[model samples]
Target: MTGAMDKVGTTGGRKRRAGVVAALLCLVVAVLSSAILVSPGPAAAQQRPRTILDMLFGNGLDRGQPYRISPRYRITDPETPERRPARRTTRKAKPQNPAPKAAATAPDQTAAKPAVAAKKEDAKTILVVGDFLAASLANGLKDAYEDNPMVVVKAAANGSSGLVRQDHYDWSTQLAPLIEANDPAVLVMMIGSNDRQPFYGTDASLAVRSPEWNAEYQRRVDEIADIAAKQKVPLVWVGAPPFKFDRMSEDMVYFNDLYRQAAQRVSGEYVDVWEGFVDENDSFIYSGPSVDGQTVQLRNSDGITMTDAGNDKLAFFARKAIDRYVAADQTSEAPAPGARIDLPPIAGAATAVRSPPVSLDDPSLDGGEALLGGGSRAAGIDFEPSPRDKLVLIGRGTGHVDGRADDFAWNDKSSAVASDDKPVAFRGSIDLQKVRKEQGIKPPQEMPSILDAIMDDWSQDNSQAAGGAAQK
Candidate 1:
């Protein structure tokens, strides 16, 4: 009994030892597998071993840890002190600031600027006069002639002045002095924006647009034009553009007509700027095509004042008249004649056949009173006219051509059939039998039914079998 008990005890000890060995082997295998997965390469393996948790979810260094990059992978940056390369020098380096170095290497500022042309001593002056609108017009004219040294624009405009408020600021009194002082080649006037108010005469105050007020306003406009006329300066009256307000735009229309007559009386050119500020429907627009043909904001937020683009457009219409006057002045002083020299003619120059200049008003330019294709038909050479000639020239319909949808003429024979030598069948809801009969086509014989054909075949086989049995 003692020996058996000792044997069981030894066996139990051997089992425990085997279990411990198996557990150790599994632990070693697990550790080696984890290390293999966590390690990136041989280089990474040489560095400090990372924890399993660290390998799974990145190291705390990425989350603002105070760890500096290793010197092996550190890039040299001047901004970073630790990353900057150390330079070996015999003497101490001087303090460096890039600002002074950049300044020293910079190009000369004066040399980069373009040279501007100087204005001529006898340059033609364009005197612009009127209210606030005229002030805007002056600004536009200045920009227009900014590059032209021979033209100078002078603004003698009173923003609050108009023909109606003569007592406050009379254009009749102010205009003559301005023309005399400037000695302008062209006198441009763009007012009436402030003239919509009531007119005050010597006796009583007249309502705006009234017959008495209109007459008085006309006289005032005439007076201003007379001043420019007496000065021998060419007058250019720029009409008021449409306003944001409908009633104000209507008033401008009436004012423009009066300005037109006044300008006409003095033989001055009247520039109508109404179409520039309005849409196709003649309605006021705050934003529209600019002088460059690009869409841009033209009016101020208040709607009454003009923006830069609006001012430029206003100048555009008035610039034509001013340019004409300036051109005339320039051309008036003709240059001295120079000696003429003729060149030798070429050996083989083709002589151009020059036709006499045709008058635009001449009626015979476009084949005269005769319609197109209606000229006299060629004699003896018989040919049918084209559809266009038939319909247009003769004012007649294109006659029916057989087989076409428009052909309604019914005949025994078809044109298509005659050409192809085959009977053409008509499609649609037409009776096929009638068409076939008209074309003289015989109807096909009726086909036998399936059961009748089977019965006929059976009877022929039975007769052949009976004839063979009788012969046997």
Candidate 2:
């Protein structure tokens, strides 16, 4: 009996070890999947560098600028004559949209306020760089925004590009001039489709410099975002859209998260338009039927690049921000000449609700929104500890309830959860209901707000001491 008992104890210990091992593996996989969701594979420039998949699909942008495209008369350098921006495209008025119904006598109409000149708008221009699909967006902007004199939008797209090893040799240097010359008001960037071609070094740690896939992708986002920051240009990094991705899809996911982190670091913005096209299963099929009584073909015949309709959709959102701004005030400084859009603070913009009961087999929640006050409050992030945990600490989503208008923070990080390695603190709203739901635990209703309870008890104790002292 003693021998049998010893064996049982040993077996139980082994089982516990196995369970922990399994949990750790699951954590790693979950994080890895989430990482790949946004990042793309990499490529170095040498060949034509076009991916049939991307060619048919797209480079992930369906929106664009003030004068999205302006391939007008050839422009010569004002000083050097050799160095010029958009040599082939000078500032020229494009056609008016849905041409305003003419009542004749239109020559006198423009006398109103001396219509603004598109060329002069270049002084406050915004720059956008992306993959080939973004070319249409650039053109669309030129067509739609030629009338807005307050802003000029310039763009350059390289067909198959990576953040680290760009297939198009000229993009980096071509784009650098704008930062050097204009120091733009805003910047819109979206690239990273062909990076999955693999360019890593022998050692994992040396991947980025060595063109290793992972490091290279990070380098791309960081390098781009950092450059924009240095230029004092607000940057908006558009996330890659879903495609009929096989191997590259996973890489795209990883890169997307990196974009978000980079954006937060620089107070930039991340636009995730992946959902506008992808279906419930995350598949990319822009065919089958039509929507809006028109052909439902959202994608080009090639299956990747967007149709004209898709570009309009993407442009609509981007333009709305621009439209909203000018209306706010005449005195408000126009967006920084090269400034990226200034969006609401994203960090600490989370809810207090936690996710409800879920099965052990679920992995979907790992990369999604944290539950907050309006509904479930807590979130169980299956954390996978990294070496960074011992170095710079960080945390995930932080948010609050709706009527919290009076309680917005002095800073965005005020409501953020502390790093997993540290004790969680709170200066902003805390959703107890959300917390309980997330931890799979519940608290009794009689428990007052943690803050209220602590202060009330302390006050009572202090008052009692004062009374006793007086009596003495």
Q: Provide the overall lDDT of each model, using Cα atoms, as 2-decimal numbers.
A: 0.77, 0.58
- Candidate 1 lDDT score at position 369: 56
How do the predictions measure up, each by TM-score?
0.49, 0.40
Give the per-residue lDDT digits (tens) of candidate 2, residues 1-472.
9999999999999999999999988976775565446534332212336555334443322222122134764444345644555434567887767667687745775566645544553346656678775665666555456665656677767777655555445455566676777666677777766555555345533332244556656766677777787777777777776656555666677778888889879988777767766667777768533223354666776566777666654554354333322221122456868879866432222331354465332233433344421233237533343323322344322233322433233454423332232224333487544664588443357858999999999999999999999999
Q: For residues 298-369, write the lDDT of model 1, one tens digit per residue.
A: 999877899999999998888766766774222234546894656543221123235346534232443445
Q: What TM-score does prediction 1 earn?
A: 0.49
Which segments of model 2 are wrong by more than 4 Å?
Answer: 1-123, 167-174, 200-212, 287-295, 320-472
Question: Would you list the clashing residue pairs of candidate 1?
Answer: none
In terms of lDDT, which candidate is strongest?
Answer: 1
